[model samples]
Target: MQHTNILIISDIEGSSLCRDYESTTFLGRGWPRACLGMSKDVNAVVRALYNAGAREVTVQDFHRTGFNIFPEIIDKRARVVQGYRQGPVPGIGRAHGATGLVMTGMHAPSGADAILAHTLTSRIARLEVNGRLMTEAELFCASLAPFGLVPLFISGCPTACDYAANAIDGLTSFPLHQEIRGSEARAMTWREQMAAAAAAALKSPAGRPFNPKGPFEAKVTLRKGSGEAQKLAARWNLEAHGPQVTIQARDLNRIYLELVRLVYLNRFTQHVLPPGLFLYRIMGRLGLAWIRRQLKNLPPSLR
Candidate 1:
């Protein structure tokens, strides 16, 4: 029998244990506790896969900066890929004989009611590939096509789970929470339940790959009032109409590259900012906290 190896791609927003922006934001008030919960969730699935007889398991921290998952608390049996990386799939290079992919802590696309819902980044208001609305799960699944691996399991909010299941045939999805309104959601299951579901999904047959045909056309709608949209359009030669930008490519890889450029265009500031700039950090924290509070106070209908 062939030894099965699996790759786990994890995010933090869809974690049932995470309830607020502070928990998912890096260096925010509840970030440490949220990181611990995210680590435990990843570790749970890792141990389950090992118990189910998987020889090797690798985890890719697919969240902000790609370093959200705590290395110290992760399962020793599983190797983890952390930090920022570039490619069709950031932080994930060659699949390396992995038979399956598991997406954990995923949320719905932008404008959805799932907790911290956003595609690629909060800067994007909407994203469409080849005229079809694209989600992070779909993009990652297509990127893994060259390696012949498929998304075997996904654990996330209900909307995200449904999206993945609908996009990939035979894909198993475990819902950690159901979004009630905007960032508000109710946890549906505990960490142990999620682990069991993931292991069972992995042991099942491999899911079909969701590989879209080539000659992809990507349409990205930047968030309203964004200051970077004009600059991005000028730099990339993208066709811009108001907040929307379009990139035409012959393949998915190029489309992915274009989207990456748009998403991280302003991220370079982090590299130049002095480490001792405590005041700036404090201001940013306050601003983010205020925005989160406003979102929390929004009516359910508006959310």
Candidate 2:
């Protein structure tokens, strides 16, 4: 109806299709980059919003390390929020401060039939705390709804786009590709997805917001046999009860940040196979001690 300030939270880049090194069904070498949709989707939405009367826009490169999306490729006119080490919550804060939000390049929850599909980590089975099914898109949109920021557009794989649209009604979703099997996809060009996303985003009658009634519950289910199970068990200072873990976030900021930390800590395991590859790459293995120390030493503002 009027000019708006938009924010984009996305996992812009995913590694090249595993080079077919892991499984036989995996996508071919560099068939595509996971971040491509994010880069393209955001650009499309930015242009659409600007035409639709957006005054300004900020794109939050909200991944674990917060380092996706090439600057040159991203909409130069929009501000980019990067880096993973931004304290507790890695990505954007409350959308309470923004006019609108958009999510792209995000995959489905761990169980979805998408390439590199895992909720928090390969170890996480599901994360549905406080009654809400928590995907990065859900968690982020939920946090923003309270602040009056509606997620208006989304683009990614089939499961990913559906996951987002279901979470936020009235929002436009363009599924870039369909993950037919692990590492394999029935390709949908980024241009096609972006065009659809742009058309949908700029369409006059926006869809209804799938805003859930709150008092939100935070839950997490990790992969069955990943090392992150051990890490979360220790980080939250709880018992390692197989692959499932649960936690609570009282407010939007808390919920969003906690999810980031979950992704951040779980980052240790994302490379060799699944996300757990981050485990070997992390310095000091990013153990529970670090989480404990930080939790114990958190500042009043953060806490």
- The candidate that wins on TM-score is 1
Question: Candidate 2: misplaced stretches above 4 Å?
Answer: 13-38, 84-90, 94-97, 129-133, 179-196, 199-211, 214-219, 224-231, 234-241, 248-303
Q: What TM-score does prediction 2 earn?
A: 0.64
Location of the lowest summed lDDT over 10 successive residues in candidate 2: 17-26
TM-score on alpha carbons, each prediction: 0.79, 0.64
What is the Å distance of residue 136 in model 2 from its true position?
Answer: 1.1
Q: Assess candidate 1 and give its lDDT.
A: 0.71
lDDT by residue for model 1 over 207-291, one digit each (tens)?
6555766888887888864355677887768787777888998767568767876676545643553442344445544544553
lDDT of 2 at 292: 35
